[model samples]
Target: MLDFNRRLFLGLAAGGAAAARFGAARAAELRPHEKELYEAAKKEGQLTWYTGQYQAEPSEAIGRGFTTRFPGVEVNVVRSTSQVAFQRLSQDMRAGVAQCDVFSSTDHSHLAFLKQNERLMPYKPQNAAGLIKAAQQAADPDGYFQVTYLGLFLMGRRSDQVSEADAPKSWKELLDPKWRGKVAVGHPGYSGAITSWCLAMRKLYGWDYFKALEKNQPQIGRSSADPVTMLNAGERQIGAAIPSATTLLSISRGNPITMIYPTDGTLMVPAPSGALKNGPHPNAAKLFMEYMTSPAYYEATRPFFSESLRPEVPPPPGSRPLDEVTMITADPDELERDGQEVKELWRDTFGV
Candidate 1:
């Protein structure tokens, strides 16, 4: 297997390529609490946030807001895919670099990994109890690593090619012969969101469901964004368990797409945030984590159409309301333990 750190660097570079393509935006108007956190960041002098949330515009917007809030503190935002981010963070911890101070990614396993390594400290940000209870429970009892947000959805092209009623409403629906070559999915091995969804299936339907999915000859893409791209381009007619908002964002650009949370079930992934146990800048790291979990900082990224785990926050436009969707539950710890076995099973069935 490739070294996780190198892969992370490559993913970060790939995302940086996108950032270069889209100019960064200044922080959107700040609310009162955001202003206070911004001042705190300024006092800290520097903050670093490494994330797997790879949408370019939102990433830049986040960086810009941090910059705006803390003019004195330079925010170095490293954007990468979650697989690479998790591997790199693991390698960094082992190598003693811990380049990331505050780590936020869609991968809950990485959050579990950080916990096992004892690389995270407990900290309940000011408003800890308000977020989703499942997400809050995932955090350290004392509040070390908490879920920042989660993205749960299914999406496809808006073109009449696939009617809303015909869209895949359950995991089993993706395996229909009609979608044989038409189905596209983000790589389960590489994407936390995709993997989390798979894990949910394993927990809900058992290993047999995954075995069947693997046989479906699903086309797996390296970029988490590719399935949406393929659907928007009309290269594929259906995709499931992707970030629906991403598909909707394409729709806004006239790419012709629509999304729905499956009635049968949807897997909610807590995009987690944590502080390195021995980070280069501990205080700044804590400040950043505290700020991000805060509602003010949370809302700043909403325009990108992803869901925050906080219940008080609303789901983005064109996305199903959380309560309306059926959700499957999987213990993060159980998923972490069985993760490798799960990936191997995927390869065996899918021939990936």
Candidate 2:
């Protein structure tokens, strides 16, 4: 017992020493302001992130990258679809548990709702200035939230099943009887990206558009990323509103799927991240908000084909720049006001 105690003590001491050295080494890589933030964050030790941005793989990769750059601070990533994440966050809030430090959601309305309820911490990240104009425009004027991620909600198809010449060229093409039962889509009630896409479609083609789409009997998944999986598996030949980044990531893996920028316009989904008002790790949350806007965050996400928030960073290869694309964007105000109505409309139309 004595020997065991001595060994355990030595092991713990060595681990502590290694952690100290790692933190010091990483701190050397930071700028003065970042170093200062890192010092405070290190004291907090970790931050819990509730994200509906990327799926688990890329989300966890970003978390790991942050830890590598800020050694003493760990990231606890809780990933889910937008509505689900929001529901979980709501549960935490109602329980008075400060479980989530940072909340990143694909639904802009979520941030607006949080800001309105005063549940979000108002903080302007210094690195936010480096964001591109579009991202800046999407940020909350009062700094309750900032756009941290961007993706195009576009169409895609299984190359093995659909020929380029025969594939859909516009959103309207999916409504044709020829593609009935072959269309895949995500549930707006579950995914914020899908909610935005629904709004964009409603704006463009009216509620009759979804009424027409429903006639074709589309397969509905919980998350926008699920369409990519369905397309890859040949479970669905065409994805009606797949996230461009997730589609590109699958394509890069040699999946037999091809992204198709709808001739009408691609919907650009701006995902925002904000610190929680009653988080356990406020300093760490602030540090994370800063990290999300930094170039390192872009670098970590670039390989996954996520659109860069900073102008200095280029889009991934094979991905078109936002300026070059005919993009459709939703207003946060509209989304905040009509999000629930759209969700209900979707449920009424699809019976899901």
Candidate 3:
């Protein structure tokens, strides 16, 4: 009877111990990075990322990369035209919704507006100090905005119709009658990067130059990514003002396409990222910003045709060496003052 009682007690104790071990193992299933992300995200419960163009592809890549390193965290992305993203952010802000976490946009137009309205909070990413000098210098004084990436070229389908040597090397070359109606343009009103390109042309050549190009009758696209696809399909043999990624990705896929980094100059527009002032997931947004901006991680994950804000992150393959290209500089003040007027002019001229 004593032995039976002792055996029963030992069995019950071992079962309890087994249950405790299983619970502890289950708790550890959440990766450390995931635990960090989850702890930060629980305050907000969700994060909404609004970004420009191919941002979805890279953003998803980053999200997968993040999840691999840190399980248990999920990231949701809302990709659209920069104009659309800004409008949504603006609307949410005005309505007191406080829905989104991270706002990833190209150019300083939205950044200027966010600052002007005090809609952005000053929260630098954890890795901000390790950014390249250019990237660091481009960040807003109070950390309201930070430069993300710089793109430098336009692309086209490499049909026998255009020779690599004869590609447009200056803005003036694009207006040649032979290329008229053959070019694809993203509506400047909706694409901040394209708008920046137009603004850069205005600064570099003259306002009259844009007026002349308008007369060339370029076919405007809805999303910036559309032109790249159109060029890939050979529906439009030439892509106007496409950034490096569109063309390079197409070329790598065996699409007969080529990119032109205008010899006269290409604009280096910095896409700025920030957290909404009253975002739903402030902590999660900050964590994401840290993830996206980390020099080490960014270098490891950068697309083959893009430039990372980290000097340590090498320029993608087939890109013009950073030193060789003369990139037009943008003035945030000027962009803020004239973005609407310029966009209006673009609308009137292009009918987009």
Candidate 4:
């Protein structure tokens, strides 16, 4: 059996001869044992990935990294909101078209639906054993889908512009008069992170929290990612609810931002990955699943500001480990049941 530990994963950072075939470039290497899978994937030469975990930019970057690591395998990334991606997959399946090789979504409910229908391919990778135990436990035990990415809705602020003394330390602080015009947030309807955050908030603080926030006139963006850009540009001093990954990624780029994990607790959502059962590129899809779970994939796509799946590769600076942070997760069943109702309430209260 081949080990997919940090050492082996790092070694495969530059692929073997198969990867070198593309150019004089440093190829993405596969394990000596994986040569067979590599050859098989080479035959398929392509895959289409549908994802709602990241926006187009980082999504494409991850795809590019995948192709770089495994030469001759081209990846076409189709990215949109979680619900939108799910709808696309449903349409393709219903139409009898195999348009996606893999599907990733921020909405946990989607995984349950796909798994129940037996639409997801079940081939657990050896690399999966290296994932964090908490996240691993959250994976579909039957192997229909696995937790691939994670993000949290935490407060963020322009550290340079917002003094530490004045910055909000908790979610309720954002409602203070001092933060009236300085706050920004993601729309619950469009962002799975925000949807989870809103749902969790309603459970913890009730709908009144959102109603009170409305009086502060918070600027609402489409997704949790938007507040990162908004805060970076100084359009808003504080992102009331943005992806912790987005904030950390920005700070890494030297943005004057600081992730503020609320005293109350943050809303962390774990996104899942699944290979489509009838995907056109089965071999590539399986291999890609291995890559997604491997440390090599983490090395290839560090821009993700991810909570490391494996303890070997730690999360970026200035963020608490998922286990260390105070987190509130929305129930997948609850989201499936009440997501629409929360979104409706959001629009009515915020008028966004």
Candidate 5:
């Protein structure tokens, strides 16, 4: 009877141990770099990342990369347009829900707004010193946000439809009678990139530039990436403001698309990432902030032709180097002042 009782007790104990191991999600086992943060994040077990930087497919890949690196931490990505993401974050805060741990948007002004409100947690990335000068300049001085990527609006077209000589090599060429009704552009209201591009163009040329372009009746879309599909489908002969990364990725896939770095200048979008101050998963969020600056993160982003913010990571193959391109970007203050005005103007002009 004694032996029977002992055996039964051991069996129960082992079953209990097994249940603890696999019955539910646990904290991720800490790594050398993330050890200090691992315990806290492990307890949290998951983080919600609100991203306006990438679409669903690429965002999921990034989340998977984070999970693969940290065994116990799961990344729940909320991907949407930059303005939409901002609106959602705003709504969540108003509702008193700490649902978002990290927020990344292509619009730089959002960082200033969040910081002004003390909504962002000040955390310097361990890899900040290794980033390029431009990327460094884009980061918040107090370390509330860091520029993770740089995407540009370049002229792109169907490779078969437009020969090299026939392609519009400058922004001025887009006004040619040839591309009228054949050019596609993203709406500023829906795309942050477009907002900046509109602001920059208005600064450089004035609202009259948009007025002239309006006469062409360009096909407008919501996402900056829309031009890639529209051009590939031969629905448009040219794109007025296609994202360089999307165009490069499409070309790599054998799509009949070719990107052009305009002789005049290209609109550069510096995407910023930040951790929420009152996040549900603070440790996980900070760890993610650090992870984004690591080479491994750049490696994961390479497949999608993401423009690298880290100096060590090379530009996506076949794309022009940043230094060689004339990239125009608006100051955060300028964005704050004129961003909404540009979007409202875009809607009025395009009527979409």
Candidate 6:
């Protein structure tokens, strides 16, 4: 809420510089398994990562950071929305082509489905132990997939257009007639975060919640990040399901946007990543998995406002601690069971 002052900005800069130094130092000395994987991965030359978690810029920056840390191995980043990435991976499987070495999606149910189909390789990362307890608990018990990215799905408003006093305080307030034509959201069929959000809303208030929201005529986009884009461009006054990291980055860049932790509960989005069983670069995929969970990975993503999985690495500036907010999350079993139904209902309710 414009509280990100010069002092905080300077502190963030200093923190980033220190993280970078630490990453460089860590890269100079690799663990035994890492060194062995590096030798095998170097022979493979590269790994293809199908990522549906972060934006294109941040995803590519992670790829570059991985390449910088482990020379001679390249990372090919293919970024898309969660559903789209899943569809592409499904197509590749049907065609018998091993294009994606690693799969990272915001929807945990996707990993569940893949594991059920025996599409994911079962390999636990050594760095997984370094993750926070909550993150560790989110991982698959059998090690088929692990939570690699954590974010919050909350509300946001264009500060210049909507005063803080007038903004909606809870998810139910979004359906008020006064906010008609002013709200922006993402389609559950296209975004995994939105799918979880829709599921949570349904569980709490029933499908009538969205039925009422439809009366407001909210603008819907493909990605959950799109609502922030709409608010930043002054095209929308409110965002019903916005990613906190994206909004914080926009605010830091002087965008007239502010985050609102809904009084009901903020949605906790835990994006999971796994290696494909039939991937072309098996060893490289394993190495990339290790890199994604390491401190160096958090360092590359801290500037983009990505939440830290490791307790040693503090969260980025202008972000709320997870403990301070009431969080709503759907488990993989629930997500796997209801994901398709949510998508179908979303299209029926919104006619999109």
The root-mean-square deviation over C-alpha atoms between each candidate and the true structure, in angstroms, is 9.2, 13.2, 16.9, 7.6, 15.8, 6.0
**Candidate 4, lDDT over the whole model:** 0.77
lDDT at 159, model 1: 64
Name the regions of candidate 5 deviating beyond 4 angstroms: 1-33
Backbone clash pairs for candidate 2 read none
What TM-score does prediction 2 earn? 0.91
lDDT of 6 by residue, 1-352 (tens): 1111233223333444444344422333777888999999999999999988999989999999999989999999999999999999999999998899999999989999999999999989998886656667778999999989976889999888889999999999999999999999998888899998888888889999999999999999999999998887888899988888888999999999989999888887778999999999999999999988887888799889987776556677887655466677665667889999989998998999
For model 2, how does the per-residue alpha-carbon lDDT over 1-352 read when each residue is reduced to its tens digit?
Answer: 0011223223223433443343311122577778898999999999999999998999999999999999989999999998999999999888988899999999988888889899999999998886655566668899999989876789998999999999999998999998999999999999999998888888888999999999999999999999889888889899988988889999999999988998888887778999999999999999999999887887788788876665545566677644455667676778899999999999999999
lDDT of each structure? 0.66, 0.84, 0.67, 0.77, 0.79, 0.85
Rank list by TM-score: 6, 2, 5, 4, 3, 1
Better of 2 and 4 by TM-score: 2
* TM values, all candidates: 0.82, 0.91, 0.84, 0.86, 0.88, 0.92
Model 3 misplaced regions, further than 4 Å: 1-38, 42-45, 155-157, 296-301
Off by over 4 Å in 4: 1-33, 321-324
- Off-target runs (Cα >4 Å) in candidate 1 are 1-44, 127-135, 309-313
Per-residue lDDT tens digits of candidate 5, residues 1-352?
Answer: 0011223223223433443343422224444667777667888899999998886778898999888887799999999888889999999989988899999998888878999999999998776665655566658989999988667788997879889998999887887777888999888887888888888778777888898898888888888888777988888989877888788888998998888888777777778999999998999998898778776677678788886655445556777655466666666778888999988887787777
Off by over 4 Å in 6: 1-28
Give the distance in Å from residue 238's predicted Cα in candidate 2 to where it truly belongs.
0.3
lDDT (tens digit, per residue) of candidate 1 on 1-352: 1011223223223433433354332334655554676566566678667788656677778777655555676767887778777777777767868577888877777877777768886666765564545556566676768767666646464466877777776666776667767777786677777776667777667778766666666668854677887787677777767776577678778776776566566665556788877777766676677657655555677677765544444556666544455555455676688777777777777777
Lowest summed lDDT over 10 consecutive residues: which window, candidate 4? 1-10
lDDT of 1 at 294: 55
The TM-score measured for candidate 5 stands at: 0.88
